[model samples]
Target: MARGSLVPETAAHAATTVARATGHRAQVDVTSDGAALAALGRTPLLLRVTAFSMFVFPSSMVIKDIGAAGTVPMILSCLLFVFWLASWIWRLHDPVRVRHPGRMAGVFFVLGIIVSYTALYGGWTGDATVTGLAAADRWLILAFASLGLILVAAESVKTMADAMQLLRWLLAGAFFCGVVGLIQFTLRVNPMEWVQLAMPGFTYNGGDTPFQARGNLVRVAGSTFHSIEFGVVSAMLLPLSIWRALYDQRGQRWFHWLQTALLVFAVAATVSRSGTLASVVAIAVLLPFLPRIARQRTIAALPFVIIALFVAVPGFVGTITDALGADTSDPSIATRVNNYPRVARMIDAKPWFGVGPGNYTVQNAQEILDNQYLNTIVSMGIVGLICVFIYLVLPGVAALHSARHAAFPALRCLAGASAAGLAVAAVCSVTFDSLSFPTFALSYPLLVGLSGAIWIMVKNEGSSPAPATTTPQTTRMD
Candidate 1:
């Protein structure tokens, strides 16, 4: 019996036969188990995160009625706290096998302290700190905590299998979100409001009621949150879909094409400038890595564009031009430019440490903090900035290294490209306001998984173990 990239059933049975002859029945079964888990374990973590309830439960039609508006996300955060608690308990039982590697968690703890302390200190200078404990602050921070919880659990406690399972679920939920977004796009409604009325604390925001925004057609964002959130949802799916298009399970080629087309339509229909642009840019960046046929298919798409334009005549082309040219005019770009000098002057008042968590948004007058970098600097101070640096830069570097050198060379192309693409988008986010969207909380974990998977796969080249097989493959999502 020979081992191939794919372990056919017959190959496994032959190995089992060999094991039986060797008087190793149990060992054969263990080998089979390891093989099965290995294939599954190779999927990327971002795909698994789709199954995360924080990503899923809110999208159903019954969100607000179920009392889930902020509640669902909140509970998801609590689940993180629970996960951490369990890790601590598990460590108590098996200290060696389950070392509390809070290596990642320690990074976050330092960040939280820096940001919180800076935010508080910024408040002390009283240049522009505004003080208040509001629901928005609580909800957003709760979401940030969820990211910390995921990394902490992933690094110190979770096995490769646990990571794989998470990606599976993340993909599953993302599929449903695509479905729900499709439904809303087709029907022009918010399903989360009506679908699961029994679930509490959920509120549906991903909808439009024939509403016009600034004279353009207002689109429904669906279960993801807002119009921008809809964009983020589409953005997350873009990479995974591209991954499947380039390298998928053997028989499902056409099926994956349909999935890709469906995502494109769903994203286009959302009519979100930022979301649409982000989705397009992200996928376009991935196009170079796609298979020749897939790449050609995208290139050949131009005729459809011309035909759609032909059908539209003047009405179609004009609307698209208008929509594309839609007013992103920063009414506030000028405001930020004017205000930041004063704000920076104020920040010079106390640049060492920031005000603390929630302080820039809370203590400062509402004007000082729309951008994440500016907000972070004003709130956390120099120490806070350094903490954020570790959180973002380290994982990004890890992912880049792995994506670049994956053992399954074809897998290397897109995983590396996607990691790089995400880094570009993340850096852009520092100056842009879109990071405030759900994608930030939703995506950081996926990035972590990619980084970890790439690193694991590269490190395990030629090794026939569970981590070697699963790390790269785990990236394949629902």
Candidate 2:
């Protein structure tokens, strides 16, 4: 009789009711198909492919002789893009209606890169290492691939279960990285060497080993291209691991907590100033939103963790402290400081749209600007820099908005975790050329897309009609 008054007793009746309310039988059928798909209990194809490409293989590995363009994740992203495009073209009805702000921002950011590249087309000088066209093409491929990931992930994740699964995959990947890093640190050996031997056609582009040294202490990169990248990635994922540890079911709690510990140890293994700072930033952003019990537990564990780190790694705490306190005399600090004047001149030449993406090579510029924000300015100009901020920061903002309004505690925790992860990425961008690295470049967009999906779920939950009072209620994951 009245809307939201009918209590369907059969599958047929439920479908009929849904069809009447939506005025589309096809929508009901699509819902049934989606349910059938979910019943299979397999990870969504895009999510699986992404996790495998990004985490299973070392980020430093590429197809033999293909260079940056041949990274496994990039190749998988391109394939996923084609699949998404074909699906979009073939779907005649019941298309996804969610319009996420993060998705819109990603589109604009990609467009800004294209605009900059078009403006500088053939006028750029060829460096001794890479041609201008080649550099631009490489960057464009990366930009497009990133956008493809954002779109696919946002569209594919249709429910809370999908979101949870995505997080699980990410956590699994981070755990793998952490374990590999700990091994590298303890054994003073690169495990990727064994991995390379096992795999054919994938070669390491990262150089002799995944180890770097500060004085006598050794730094480990795990599966990432550099120790700094490894540190930043661990810092970003730490919040998610902590969220799982605190909120996941009791049976899985121990495993998640172990994952959290591994990530902390991995970060310490890197001995990176930015990584340590990024970890602190993640914790600061995440702690305020966690429940009282979680917050208390985290605070209480801090002293023990610090004591363990001291005993386990010996000089780690002092190394991080000294690095943070280092003055301009420090080589890294001096390099960053000295680049400002040169970067200003470069920005002055073409303030609106600079030389072009990937054109600012160390070969031509004579120095590497570790700051991604500065790199964005030099390569894509002020407009591109603004776009970069929007693309990176908007998802976290959206995640926070969802967390504030979400009906379920689990959803809220997830939202907070996503926000914290993105915050780490945002803060770390200033400390390194984060996007230039394959691991972060791929991981960041996937997280953004997942956050957009979380936002959509919150919005959909808010818009749906309430259930009838007479019906027996069961808990919903969302």
**What TM-score would every model get versus the actual structure?**
0.67, 0.85
Which tens-of-lDDT digit does each residue in 1-478 have in candidate 2?
A: 1212322354344333322221212211112212312322223544555664576577566786667678677877765555555455544213356578778877877887888788677554223234767778877888888887787677666654556566677778778778888889999877777876766677766632479987557999887788898889898888878766654433465787898999898888889998888889888888866766667778898899989988999898888888889999988898899889999999998787777888886753337899999999998898889888887777788888887886555556667888899889888899998888888898998888878877776776655444232210112111
Model 1: residues >4 Å from true position, as ranges?
1-52, 59-70, 92-144, 147-149, 152-165, 201-215, 245-255, 284-339, 342-346, 361-370, 417-421, 462-478
Q: Which stretches of candidate 2 lie over 4 Å from their true place?
A: 1-43, 92-96, 122-130, 207-209, 363-366, 464-478
CA error at residue 154 for candidate 1, angstroms: 3.9
lDDT accuracy of residue 397 in candidate 1: 57
lDDT against the true structure, per candidate, is: 0.48, 0.72
lDDT of 1: 0.48
Residue range 112-187, candidate 1, lDDT tens digits: 5545554454456344433333422543454455454444333421223333344445555656666677666556
